[model samples]
Target: MELDCTAVIADVWLMLDGECDESTRARLQHHMDTCSPCIEAYGIEEKIKGLLSRKCGGDRAPDSLRDRLTLEIRKSVTVTRIETTEA
Candidate 1:
């Protein structure tokens, strides 16, 4: 499939994260290789991903906290909206 700048911008995250498959990767890579704007975006995203990996990849939440969060997530939630009064 032919890709434009918008397509590359949209998929930069997938490419940077290595989430897309090889064929899609190749297509995005090819476009990035040839297109200046796509390449610039790709470079910026690459750096951001790299920085995030170095900063946050090693941190993990405590198991107790994780369990509490999991338990809370399993419970149902209810939302109620209150009407606002205006003078």
Candidate 2:
């Protein structure tokens, strides 16, 4: 099966996060091996993820920021629940 750019892009993150199935990961890697643009994007994303992982390792989010994100998530969940019920 031929892979399109959209499909490759969609699964790139899952592949990076080690969450994708072997078949899908192989397909993505095959595309990256052949496609220059996808390879470049993949490299950039990998670098960014690595940088964030290293940076976040010994750091913690301040209480204020954590509280704000918590509130936002809760609000988002509530809104989604209400929309689901309406639907």
Candidate 3:
């Protein structure tokens, strides 16, 4: 199956956070292995996630903030999915 970089980029956090299934992780990693843009995006996302983890290692986000972030992430993923499929 062909991989969509936008979808892969959107799921970078999922891969980094170990939230995806093994097959999904393998698929993403394989795409990164061959796709420079995706790997680059993944690297940037990895750094951001690492920074967030270090800054807020033990702290929980406020419910409002967490809800906002989740909503925004879903919106982004939804848009990415739509754009990728339409292309």
Candidate 4:
């Protein structure tokens, strides 16, 4: 059977996140083993994920920033509720 590259691409994130089942992982690994394009794509994705993990790992979000975001979200939700009630 021909491998469905589109389906594989769609599930790449799940595969990378280690959320896929054993069967799925095996299928993806098989595909990657035989397909150079897929292997290169996977390598790029792995690098990107690694870079993002490093960049966002520590002290990325200050507590004050989080608190302010929470306050803003609450204020927006309150305003939205009032607007919906009036409408």
Candidate 5:
């Protein structure tokens, strides 16, 4: 049977969070057993989640840093919009 990539991505969050029922987990596992690309994608996502959790889990950000980051992001967005419009 061919596996649906859309369904797999949609269910990935549920599977990672342990919210999927046993049957759904089994089905996903069965697909992963034979699909290398999906397995690689899942691994990359898992690593990203782990890194984010470790980075932002308990660190309290300073207000000054937060404000600076917000300003930088807004500037970046404006630049991106201008570039896209010119293109």
Candidate 6:
């Protein structure tokens, strides 16, 4: 099953969170290996996740905090989608 850039981008977060099955993860990895744009994109996301995790530390974020973060991420993704479409 070949994956396109959009498909890989859509699932990259799930793979990073270890929510993807082994097969799906393998497919994503292969795409990342072959696609320089995806590699860059995934690398940026991974770094952001890592930084957030480290800063947030061991304790779970409060529900309000999580919700707000989710909203922010959604907004950012929306903006990115618009920019990509324009480009």
- If both were scored by TM-score, which would come out higher, candidate 2 or candidate 4? 2
The best candidate by TM-score is: 3
For model 4, name the residue pairs that clash.
none
User: Candidate 6 — which residues are off by over 4 angstroms?
Assistant: 61-87
lDDT top scorer: 3
CA lDDT, candidate 2, residue 18: 88
Root mean square deviation (Cα) for candidate 6: 3.4
Which regions of candidate 1 are displaced past 4 Å?
59-87
Residues forming the 10-long window of minimal summed lDDT in candidate 4: 1-10
List runs of model 5 lying over 4 Å from the truth. Answer: 58-87
lDDT of candidate 3 over 1-87, digit per residue (tens) = 778776787678778978899999999999999999889988998898788889987686797995687568868877977887899
**lDDT of each residue in 1-38, candidate 6, tens digit only:** 88877777767777887888999999999989999999
Query: What's the lDDT for candidate 1?
Result: 0.69
Tell me the tens digit of each residue's lDDT in model 1 across 4-86: 66656767777776778999999998888889977987788789878877899767669798567545533311111112222
Per-residue lDDT for 49-86 in model 5, tens only? 67877989867569798568656655665676578779
Global CA lDDT of candidate 6, please? 0.82
**TM-score, every prediction:** 0.61, 0.62, 0.73, 0.60, 0.59, 0.67
lDDT of 2 by residue, 1-87 (tens): 888665675556578878789998999999989999778878887998789889889576697985686566556656765787799
TM-score, model 2 to reference: 0.62
lDDT of 3 at 33: 99
lDDT against the true structure, each candidate? 0.69, 0.75, 0.83, 0.71, 0.70, 0.82
Worst 10 residues of 5 by lDDT: 5-14
TM-score, cand. 1: 0.61
Q: Write the per-residue lDDT of candidate 4 for residues 1-87, one digit (tens) a residue.
A: 556555555456567868789998999989888888778877887887688778888545676985685566556656765787799
**By TM-score, highest first, what's the ranking?**
3, 6, 2, 1, 4, 5
Residue 10 Cα positional deviation in candidate 3, in Å, after optimal superposition: 0.9
